[model samples]
Target: MTDTTVRSTGRLRGVLDRIAEARRGDSSESLAAVFLLIATLLALLWANSPWGWTYEAFWHTHISFTVGGTGIDLDLQHWVNDGLMALFFFVIGLEVKRELAIGELRDRSQAMVPLTAAIAGLALPAVLFLLLNPSGPEASAWGVVISTDTAFLLGALAVIGPGKAERLRIFLLTLAVADDVGALAVIALVYTDELHWIPLVVAILGLAAVWQLRRLRVWRGGGYLVVSLITWVALHESGVHATLAGVLIALLLPVYPPKRREVEWAAELTKRFRQSPNPEYARTARLGLDRAVSVNERLMRLYQPYTAFIIVPLFALANAGVALTGETLLAAATSPLTWGIVLGLVVGKFLGITGSTALLRRKLPPGLTMSQVAGGAALSGIGFTISLFIVDLALTDDEALADQARIGVLVASVLAALLGAVVFKVAPAPEGPSMELLRPVDPRRDHVRGPVDAPLTIVEYADFECPFCGKATGSMRQVREHFGDRLRYVFRHFPLDEYHPDARQAAEFAEAAAEQGRFWEAHDHLFAHADALDRDGLDAHAAALGLDVERLEEDLRDGDTANRVADDDIDARTSDLPGTPTFFLGVTGQTPTRLEGPHDAATLIAMLERMATAASPEAPRS
Candidate 1:
């Protein structure tokens, strides 16, 4: 019998995996559906409920960040949607890199369905809206139905059962990503009030400076942040939607490395150290090494919390608030724009997506099942967050229209979410899982053995008896291949001596092998047989690697190698390496940049490129 717990976890796992995967593809609409639902609900409730007046009053209250006599003034809502949302766009930018690099968009075959469906999904909705609203005042608000908010959609799906969750999740995500492309187009073409070329130009220059810094591998978060402020201001003043500044700056960021040049430089640097001649040089080198290590430690501490705590949560809190009241509901239903949006998302999304998917599945070779597509299409209507955003933006001049749109989005999103849950529950699982099962990748080993000069470093720390460590090797190998020399892979020992009684000795065996110029070989052997990392197994691995077993045994007994392994663990812990296969890419010599967990090559490449340019001399000068 299928393990029920496994199935449930698999579903949750699929949701996260899809999020990671969809970040690369432009087709993450399912997530949007859920985000829209929550945002719209919050917005509707904030507008109509008892708290509605308070919410509105609160949002309208102005806040400012001032320096000297100058300050930026914005209402609380503006801070959320414009200021905080920039970080959201930054995440979107990161996902765009992943997709274009190695995800679904990377393959022409995989891309065709989403691109075609996205085009149809977008076009069908606008045409449907035009047919419904005609030339009346509501015509211009047609952009509301065209959006797909990934966060809201996925969040809803998380509540549902998990059978065939992976497939449906993938379908909805790619579809939504397609919708984003169209949404961005609408913003650029239809939304702007006037062109402020001079400030816009300044924004571009600021962005260019950021790009230069990224190329130089300047992993200084503050540096790009300062540039982002200027760019947003310039764009805002330029009569472009200031939020577009987020998108624009995100695009200019360098996400890939400078090819083999950096890799070769690192290897050469390492080789030079191995061949150092002068005794005096060693003393000087020690000081330099110490300084470099300290610099890396300090940089890591500074960057993580700022992005995680300051940027992300602020965006969420600000954007998550929307008022709901009885007056708003009446206003929402009466408003043509909001009505159109509600019907379009709730009804139009299901019809357009499901029908189009069915027609396309019959005609196209690369297609998911109709049931899966239908379930996914249902999920696509969970456009609460982005839908609310567009509703606010689309009907800025007409409060009635905006209120109606929020109601429509909220109601439609809920209906869609419920429908998606029922359908996914009944959908049959295919025999073979297509998307690779994600195995955890260890960071400790990758951290220690991984090169200092390497653009991306993956450190794996593991106990030889740990089952998770055994599973991680395949996943990491795939990463190594994808990144090639761009990554400097490392392996370290944290044998969890308490968990597995003999694992400490096994770690010592691997350390001893490193001294004998065969650390990698022994490292692989230990993990390959992690189930049996006892003395017999380690000894066999040593013998297999053609090491002098007698000498290796003697070294292991002395405990010196074990002490060194302990030091490696201490280093990893100090660096905030979260778990096995925790990754840190120095990106450049300037600072420490870390991406925790089992990340794809694309993220690593993007981080490396950003670091390189950010640290360049031309960065600040520009």
Candidate 2:
């Protein structure tokens, strides 16, 4: 090739790389929603095409698996809805487990706002859906409008939501969890066929087996899979929704925060892998890393991609293929079933969530505005997945009625997206005020650890004697242990003189130890024994750490060390930091940005990784 051709190829490759990198910036929900939208459109297109009969022929095809007439059989559509969609519900169950175990739902006070909103969101929509179709077969279809398609709602938020809507997203996600729970209960209780007593008993036994397996600390994936399969088959045989088996199994999976010891073991393995680049070491490190997170989180990461990108979309293709004939459209135009679903979803969801939010305004997490809440509530009406899922179950005997219900779902979802966009446009969330650190990380002045020239820096303003700081130090320590030499950690003294009289002296002691090149040693010792920070106690700690007590005494006798500790306090006061254990993070050599909310090690490392990826030279500007 000529030089011009080679140059053009290079430019094209660069553009492609940037495009891929930019796509990485999109949330999982956004990608899932995009795929679901494509499938919905394709299904509609295929169903209306000249070969429309083939669409029905394709999904109606039988698929069976048997071991001497013992296994089950289902059509392509039933397989997608019952078999593949189980994985989707399984991922949801994992999320629910994690949240109840350690996330926002664990805190009753913190969870009440979203929980109430979700309850309202659930009840009002069903009530509205029932009001119009009060006496007919359509009234049972109330479950259709009671759920919000979380992926679509989140995708719409990503597209047209206010900038920095993480808080709003979190609020909505919490609400959606309750929505999912309510929907699943309705499916199990309100939509089951005739029960088979023996199979139901066996299903109960399977659930017990799952719970026992969890309690016994079963580590093998295959063991869980076999038992879960047995439970699912039994449930299906019992005339129950087999998808509920996913929930039963997942709810039994243990979910918990990574203990410090677990993280340390992973860090040790990672360090060994780094030192010796061997397959054995690498595998060991990977296993250790996997073990640090709970089984629930691991399974979610494993299955969520398949559920979001493939299974759910295929379900849409099988279920969403409704031909809108002129006669059908005219009938649906005046159908109360159609209007009930639309109003129940689009209007009911907005009023319920927003109204609940209004009642619990004071209980909301800080930084959430009414506009953001309203927008999120509007988006919650996009009830696509479960709406259509319920349509099939509720109107099993009437294909035409099911199609009308599907029409309502599709219409409500589109309108909800549009309505959310408009609400977000008209009442946008307020932009956050700038929060940059007053003092940048300085190698000469700050107590820096790891590589001093590391690309990422996290500066912490902590009081040595504060119990809160002691707890925060553990998280920071885990972060340091994980990142190793890739990140720099800076410690600044922000001793609250009024609260802890000895805190200032503790800071001076740490600075004095710095003069002897043992600052970090003293720092760790101080926090480990924060309950005892008097002069005699600190002197004992210095002696234990082999620091020169004479030199420490000499430094404390003087004002220079005191002045150095005071400098950090001045920076904290001017920075408007509320108290000790405040954290700021950014790229090295830039003003660090203050961290808000809980500063868990996992969250911190993830945030830093994103920052590093964006700042890397190879990642071209998009």
Model 2, TM vs. native: 0.68
Clashes of 1: 88
Consecutive 10-residue window with the lowest summed lDDT within model 1: 433-442
Give the alpha carbon lDDT tens digit for every residue of 1-622 in model 2.
3333333333433443343233222546678889999999999999999998999999999999899968889999999889888889998898888667655576667679999999999999989988899987988899999999988888888888887555677688889998999999999999997899899999999999988988887754677899889899999999999999998789999875444355556666766766688999999877776676567756776777788899989999999999888977876788889989999999999999999999989776545778889999999999999999999899989988888899999999999999998998898434444478765566877889888998788989999889899998889988988778788999999999778867987998898888899999999999999977764477579889998877776665444575577667766764567888888888855677999887888888887877777678574222
Best by lDDT: 2
Q: State the lDDT at 178 in candidate 1.
A: 69
Assess every candidate by TM-score: 0.56, 0.68
**What digit string (tens of lDDT, one per residue) describes model 1 on residues 467-549?**
77777676667666765666666665665644675576678777778767787787788888776554445656777789987
In model 1, what is the error at residue 177, expressed in angstroms? 2.5
Judge candidate 1 against the unseen true structure and give its global Cα lDDT, from 0 to 1.
0.60
| lDDT against the true structure, each candidate | 0.60, 0.82
Q: After superposition, how far is residue 288 of candidate 1 from its true place, in Å?
A: 14
lDDT of 2: 0.82
